[model samples]
Target: MDKAMQKVNERLTPEGKMDVLSKWEVHTLLTASKERFSYEFRACSLAVLNTGSTEDNAKAVLEQYPDFKIEVIQQERGIKLQVSNAPAQAFVDGEMITGIKEHLFSVLRDIVFVGNEIETNPRFDLEKTEDITNAIFHILRNAKALQTEVLPNIAVCWGGHSINRIEYEYTKEVGYQLGLRYLNVCTGCGPGAMKGPMKGANIAHAKQRITDGRYIGITEPGIIAAESPNPIVNELIILPDIEKRLEAFVRMGHGVIVFPGGPGTAEEILYLLGILLHPKNKEVPFPMILTGPKSSEDYFKQIHHFIESTLGFEAQQKYKIIIDDPALVAREMRSMIEDVSDYRRSTSDAYYYNWILHIDKEFQLPFIPSHENMSQLELHKDQETHLLAANLRRAFSGIVAGNVKEEGILSIEENGKFQISGDEEIMTPLDKLLSAFVEQKRMKLPGSEYIPCYEIVKPRNLS
Candidate 1:
């Protein structure tokens, strides 16, 4: 821990959205670290207080401030949070930053609600796919994420948290253009590409006098500590897992714009492609764009080549690649999403959520990236292309876990790197694509050398 990273003590009452809590809710929030839900709520709370941290490693961040503690105190009128040894950056002079405070309470809000209402309630049957989708809808509805009056304007941006200065600037430019068109921005809500768009959109919203510009950040507990909620996020929702988070993005946003990123970005692309490839969703008018700066053309090219090699040209046809033109990216998205609006209107689907999109249960189920499970992934081309994309999505997802997630990193430490073996056809392209990510420094931030967490293996021919 740097000695300069000061700690502060404060007791705060929730303001704005999360001002009140029941005694039972307050008790659950207070005892988060000691119960069935594990230490996630506590860890996420700490992450909220440590916003603006440049460090990407979750384990390192937690170890650095081992003494930090947060407690929820119940009151007759409401509840209060007592935080000790919180990172001083969340404060100015002696008061906590208003956004950080709101985020902290939001963490508490989601954790408690998920634990009580979704997990334990008998009304929700998690085993059923429809029930899972219902749970997500309820969670978003509870958080006020769904707005009935608003037209389709939410654009979900996917990209790497570790990006170069040029790419980061390009993201902001694209974001600025989107905001000028009165489009709201939603992202993973971390640093690098995730934060860049929100930051840029804020300025444009200010210029256009758009007061209620929504900057929604959706994340899951497993990766939240690594990618803490950036300060610009006015609406932050923590889904139960990565699969649910991906589903939430697809179901909520009208369109998607993918920026240059590492395996995590690949995971998102594969996930979306898998959903789109399903025969049920083939006609769904979901606008997809892959855009970045001129320097990033090769990055998109490698991604495109990999997709062509594995999923074929039809999968490649699902999205368009536009490099070095932020204004064009925004204009194209604006024009394309109108088609989305028209489709929904014609089908009588809700504007706020995409109920018409059919996602297979395979994509909805959470995949634990344990070594055995990772090694068992069917990376061969024998399966349906959509199913293959799901497996490929899981492969990239496991890599992302090993790269920045604490448990995955520790697992790699305990038992070497994850062994990913597949047909030569897949391994060759997969290895080449991952090599490009490392070469471009997309695996980790600029200063750190990224040690790979998975090894690509090509199986030998059997005579």
Candidate 2:
């Protein structure tokens, strides 16, 4: 069958900060060497061109546009992106949408910078925890995401793209409230919960005559295909991986409000908990609130139970769960923002970034979702609670990979389901928690049956 064809060529300059690229950076981006770096960049660029597409499956999207290609052209002034067989929605009267064009090139800028400067730069030293944090800071700085003089107002919202109508409306309500308080919104930068907040905040921002409100989106390559940057995102930054993306959220946002979500959201919560549970971070004043509509009360119940059972009361105590009240959620976030402001003043930390939180190396390193890696994860209480949170974070990360990421899906197709073995005390609750997510259509978009991507195995003696 002949594929749908929509071709357009356009030249776009930086809208926000990416106005020019260095000569070497432009050269590296243009040269397609068929290396892993180039391949990854190509994949991510394809995903960016596929913005506004309704299809959620990355494999399906790639298959549809198998011949789609992008190339960077160096000009006397700067760089231009050439494309072929791109999506029609990204064009109007055969011209690329200005925002989409900026986003497309932003992908190029970030992919090239991360590939050449951060990943290959030996100075990054990904093995060391501080080095990794520095790398994250530098990437965000390069993207001009960090404002040295800004206040602590960015609120990171976490939830799933597959959420139902009621839950999505709840997210919008919470976002509207946050906007009324002049708090900017940050999200994984996709649809559903992510988009709802921005949408609501846009209205509130307009109402409050706040023209400079920021809707920042932090995403990674692996998940961007499934969750394209929503149209509302004024600033989009692509982290190298999910781990860095989560780290970026915590480091940048003043407060967090988690809505109903799936394994991905669970992974984010665990990542934050792991960091906050650290002894050095015991006094850190980060405010985390998990809230949803009345219908989602049961969802949080299961999540609360799982956290209590696996990570114990201390982990559970680290976050507050507010249900059925968007006003209260926003009010609490506002109050906490003041508290955050006071704490940062006392500690003399930057308002734009959290400099005092101590993130361990275990949480910074990328967790490859291979079967061996998943099976070898330490999920017992033999270590520190924060460390166990890191391992559990990895477990959910594997589940997220299996469900959506292209490579993880391909791995599962070839080797069957990922095997997750751990102490029964942990595995039992995990199984229950994941099972609830599956039943509630939280794992994937509704109307699609979700096959178990992982097998939960309980240790004999612990059971």
Best by lDDT: 1
State the TM-score for model 1: 0.97
Q: Which portions of model 2 miss their true places by more than 4 Å?
A: 1-17, 32-36
Task: Assess candidate 2 and give its TM-score to the true structure.
Answer: 0.96
Tens digits of per-residue lDDT for model 1 on 156-263?
999989999999999999999999999999999999899999988899999999999999999998888879999899999999889999999999999999999999
Tell me, by TM-score, which candidate is best: 1
lDDT of 2 by residue, 346-381 (tens): 999999878788988899889999999998999888
lDDT of each: 0.89, 0.86
For each candidate in turn, the TM-score is: 0.97, 0.96
Checking candidate 1 for backbone clashes, the offending pairs are: none
- Model 2 gets an lDDT of 0.86
